[model samples]
Target: MQLVVKPVPDTASNQCLTESCAWHGFDTNPPFEDIVELHYTGYHEKKKFASSREDLGEPLRTEIGTGKVIKGWDEGIVSMFEGEIARLVIRDDFAYGAYGYPPMIPGGATLTYEIELLRIEKPTSNHKLKPSH
Candidate 1:
């Protein structure tokens, strides 16, 4: 399903991730893959009309491991390197879908997370997933 995307401001504002982030700028060169730890500061908006869910606050700290986080987080953080931060404007489809959570997150929630890449731990065989029969 195609979502109506809102254009993030070209100039970095207080409403954006951090002072140094390229808020709406595109990456000309992509970074290598590894573990990236970040310190995010942003808000989470609930799309659906569920009054139970609350708006998540800013400056939220999160850890992103390969395939261990939500799709938005996975895709959003991959472009960043250690000490790099960015504001991730996530659509509901990229977030929690139809199933709404009570008193926290709602269905079809669109959120914006200001993320910082704290560290990147290279993938090792010790952390590889074993095949399931």
Candidate 2:
């Protein structure tokens, strides 16, 4: 039997990982314990991989600078302002990397997220906010 091999494309060095996000304004600066509501659609190889239905699903709510999500997402969201829309381009190291995310994200895949920041809110007591050491 013969073995087959496939090459993984790096998407042109993955566009500098998380990219340099532009700060919208300082009037509404992001706090360490700030919570955010946002909508996003993820894509790899220019095909949609993840997202919720616009009519049925609620926006994702999470704390900023937390590792709850991927590294790229956390960093990208930190630079955004309320009601701002932007795209985040992330490389494998910041994304799923060599192992990838099962059947969805392939190995060495570069992920892109079209995101909209709904709101930046003060952390409610219910949220577990821990200072990053």
Give TM-scores for every candidate, taking all chains together and pairing residue i with residue i.
0.54, 0.72
Candidate 2, residue 26: lDDT? 32
RMSD of each: 10.3, 10.8
Worst 10 residues of 2 by lDDT: 1-10
Q: How much lDDT does candidate 2 score?
A: 0.66
Clashing pairs in 2: none
lDDT of 2 by residue, 16-64 (tens): 4554233232345456558877788889989988884453287777777
Scored against the true structure, residue 22 in model 2 reaches a CA lDDT of 33
Error of 2 at 122 (Å): 1.7
User: After aligning candidate 1 to the native by TM-score, how far in Å is the CA of 13 from where it should be?
Assistant: 25
Local distance difference test, each candidate: 0.47, 0.66
What CA RMSD would candidate 1 show?
Answer: 10.3
Expressed as tens digits, the lDDT of each residue in 1-133 for candidate 1 is 2222333334333132222354323333123335444455435552333111133332323334344556566665654545654666766665566774445566876666665565566555656432110
Q: Count of backbone clashes for each model?
A: 4, 0
Residue 99 local lDDT, model 1? 71
Least accurate 10 contiguous residues by lDDT in model 1: 50-59
